[model samples]
Target chain A: MKSMASTSDKILDIAQSLIVAGGYNGFSYADIADAIGIRKASIHHHFPAKAELVAVLVDRYTKQAAAGLQSLREQAASPADQLQLYIDYWRSCIENASQPFCVCAMLASEMQMLPDEVALRVRTHFRNLAAWLTSVLRAGVEQGLFRLDKRPDEQAQMLMASVHGAMLSARALGDPGLFMAIVAPEIARLRDT
Target chain B: MKSMASTSDKILDIAQSLIVAGGYNGFSYADIADAIGIRKASIHHHFPAKAELVAVLVDRYTKQAAAGLQSLREQAASPADQLQLYIDYWRSCIENASQPFCVCAMLASEMQMLPDEVALRVRTHFRNLAAWLTSVLRAGVEQGLFRLDKRPDEQAQMLMASVHGAMLSARALGDPGLFMAIVAPEIARLRDT
Candidate 1:
């Protein structure tokens, strides 16, 4: 049982990275096999189809994102600080090339080709992230820590779009610094009041 | 010769749509063949390789984008109006499901998997766009019609990221309205000053 769980975790990690680096069709089972040094049959045993594997991968990502937000909420003293931490986390990811961009956002750009189940999982992630962002922005607004010309949800959508878009620009321009340069000011603007 | 040119143009059109709908590796020569009612061998005659096909596609897209921005510059009266029309172009694309999202941005997310030539073309598009946007923003600032916290080039990066990012959110959320809802505020903020 322990070995099975570990194998499953390993598979998800590989899939997540592949999806992040490319898109839905960018990597194949053979690619995964080569990377993990495992036979194709073993992968089949874990995930019957590519869709099943991707569906699970997206679900896992959604949960991890939510958990990260939850931990930030618990650890931070203010909503503004929580938002800053979130930006910093993504900034570090972009800078180190540890995770160049958001997997959900990457998948989101390729939504048309994703399996229906996997696509739904990706949408669920955006919704959940938007909700979390709105919650933080709303709290900040009510607490008089942030100013808004629109609703929290609207601001969340804008900020989410900017963050993901900044990653694209940074990767495309081959300049990791561009991500923070684009995003930090926007986050600061939210609290400029 | 004319027919051959027309066929080549048709292939690029279909390939661009497929790339927008999915990513770099999403479509195949067979898919293009099916779309244009041509044989794979014929597609081979035109493109010869997937990388070559995509390279030409990216090049064509870059030119079209540059042309679009150019026309807007000549026709629009003010820098702010030029920016508004730019946002409106993307918003209309998203609303009508025409272009929907920027193909260069889509390809940017899948940069690591792209052929070197194709990836370079994608990067070229970004650089050209940033240059055009910076030009517009600088004109706006000089005209005293807009305000920016960063240099025009940096502001251009933020605005470009936000525009492309909004498209991702709108698509992921299955709501095209989200595009304008997110972008309008940022644009308005620029002109608000």
Candidate 2:
């Protein structure tokens, strides 16, 4: 029974990887079963349907990402540092190939194709990240650690868009260094006197 | 014979619209044929396969986009004006709903699912746009119209990435105004001494 539980976990991990590489329609349970050396029936037993599988994946990814952001927030001395830490984390991810593609980014690209539940989850993820970022920027401004002429929410949206755009550029150019190049100045522009 | 040409052109036009709304795999020949008041067999007769249809679409989009950019270059009095003209064109597209989504933006989102030829064409579009923007930035710097701390190529990439990123954000947020808000400041920043 324990082994079966491990197998289910394995299936979810593989599915996330495939989904990040492609979009929702890019793979199927049969592909997951083949990749994991499990029977098609076994995948059905675990996930039941594609929508359910992606919903769970989005849920898991959002939770994990939120926790990660929380940890970053706790570790940084200031909101500016927190923002740097966030961008730096993504830079490392790109440089080390730890996560060649961001899960949220991949899902955002396929927003039109995703089920409503899955799309809602993806939308929630964006809102959560942007809100966290807005708070961080607001704190930075209050503490005189950052400068911005626009509202925190607008700046946060711009920053988020730039980050996602950098990911697409990196993927298109096949060079991770470009990611840092695209993001560094945006971060630098936030430094306050 | 002319009517036959018009029918084929109509299919391509509808196909582009559907593909923009959805991704590459979002629609079918039947959908295009139905929208065009034709038979599925007619679509098949024009393109024979989805891959071929998309390939042709990508090619035509790239060519037309390049021509549009060239026209912007020819009509503008300066490089700065040219860049603003480019942004203004996209802004109008977003505002008037002429083209709410860029073909390359849609294709970039589906790169993982696209065939090699289609993917190459998409990449080429990015490369061409980046190269043109770089040349414009370089000219602006020389003409004392713009100031930048980075190489023209890098800055151009940043600008292009920001534009694409803004599109994703605007689409996800269901607010076309957000697109202008994200990009206008970036353009203003470049014009700032």
Best by lDDT: 1
Error of 1 at B155 (Å): 1.0
Please identify model 1 stretches exceeding 4 Å from their true place: A1-5, B1-5
Q: Which ten residues in a row have the lowest lDDT in candidate 1 chain B?
A: B1-10
- RMSD (Cα, Å) for all candidates, in order, is 2.3, 2.8
lDDT of 1 by residue, B62-106 (tens): 888899999999999999999999999998899999889888999
Cα lDDT tens digits for candidate 2, B1-193: 4445577778889988887777777789989988978899988998988988888888899899999999988999999899999999889988886777788777776676688878888888889999999999999999889998689999998898899888877777667898899998887888746
Model 2 chain A weakest lDDT span, ten residues long: A1-10
Candidate 2 Cα misplacement greater than 4 A, ranges: A1-5, A96-98, B1-5
The numbered model that scores best in DockQ is 1
| Every candidate's chain B TM-score | 0.96, 0.95
Question: On a 0 to 1 DockQ scale, where is model 1?
Answer: 0.90
